[model samples]
Target: PGAAVVADAGAREGASKCPFSKENMAMEGAPTADGLLAGERYIAMNRFQVRDGSEAQFEQRWAQRKSTLLQLDGFRWFGLLRRVPPTGEAPDFEYPDDYSYVSFTIWETKKNFNSWRKGPAFKEAHGGGNIFSFVGMIVNGFMTSKGPPKPAFWRSMLMEKTSDEKPILRSGPGGRPDADGQQTLDPEVFVSMNRFTVAEGREQEFEQRWAKRESKLDGLPGFRYFQLMRRDQTPDDDVNYISMAVWDDRAAFDNWRNGDA
Candidate 1:
């Protein structure tokens, strides 16, 4: 369980337009503009690079400890995504042999997640050095947790739900319809995770490019769902973004990457 926790750490010195509550200096207590619990809805992406011959053991260990989080409040759905090799042509990015796996967990609220982090369960799961003992040469990358800058950002940028007339994807554990009606991951899907470090003062430009590309990507073969996330910025950290796309399989993903779509 090589997990890195990500969450908003309150306002930065220069970001006067930070969407979180200024009065609530404590990150755990800060509230969203909608008056919902601070960090009420969040997603944590924990990426791990597993050594050869330890894939089965790493997955088994993950399964055994997953139950610990299930008992915790605010814990929602969790998906363990494994990187698959491309069948045909490869994508623009390199897919190394040392396969990467990412655990994406959704939390009902940030406070509950924070509690889990501070509690004994979190310590035993992530701090016991068990992960290193089982999976050699692992690198964990923690993605965004602060969510979008505002509620409007989600409406404009995130994936929407299927209509009543349309067929829905197979749901997984802790998977629930969000306020915007988007469902979680389906079984047997291939996931593409991309993290971006935006150039300072160019956030809007990056978002615009993403929005434009998303429109084109939506029509591509095997495309399932897409999510764009903004990581919470602390005083010492720079603002970053992460995007995830689910496809039917590696072939579908490869097709989209190689074609114009």
Candidate 2:
């Protein structure tokens, strides 16, 4: 079982073409080559913790770098998510202010993502010294390799997108409040990324558990969307998964974690 990966919504928007259009995504269908079907799509998640007061610089560099990804083939959509601070006391896993940002990208396939990493764009965007130095050091070391490095830098593949899952579309930046006055999730809403590592041959069991728990989550307040993802498997790697959830605020998330769900 892989861990759940949560991504907040805070990345600079790129002018890329999103494969999952509102109409198309709303259709009830099987996993299609062009749609978010289970086991068909890949998600690349990059987590970061910028130095103090450098959030603006980090975002600017990310926006510039994202333009390169958008121009590549198979690129779908990208979002830079900032971790929202809890209104009450902090959770145990909460990091200090430093490592609080995450980048989420969707690709058509793992092969497509691998190709982009080997192409010139990857070199230009990440070769030079930038804010990604923390993870770049590990990434750059594998520049000569054909596939991604071992222990991927927060990369995971889409294993399951349940039929009941709803797409949380936003009208604009920062999202607007709903009819009930509850804030609909946008880039600024709090997000939780949970990652897991499952033993081999247990993928089906893991998904079953998720399906059962998801029903209760749907009824909770502030819960917006959820996606269960598995990491691309290598010859020697154990199975991995990520569960991503979006929430209107920290209180709602904490409520579910505490007991409501």
Sliding window of 10 residues with minimal summed lDDT for model 2: 1-10
Q: What's the CA error at residue 135 for candidate 2, in Å? A: 7.9
Model 1 stretches astray by more than 4 angstroms = 1-41, 66-73, 85-99, 119-157, 161-187, 211-222, 233-239, 258-261
| Worst lDDT 10-window in candidate 1 | 147-156
Q: What Cα-based lDDT does every candidate model obtain?
A: 0.47, 0.48
Which tens-of-lDDT digit does each residue in 1-261 have in candidate 1? Answer: 111111223225444222222422223311123321122256655444444444554454444442477678887656676665445556433464232556676676656666865676665554354423212212221213332122111111355322223344323322322312122223366777676667655666666676566356655667776766655432122325667677777788788778875
lDDT of 2 at 157: 37
What value does the lDDT take at residue 235 in candidate 2? 17
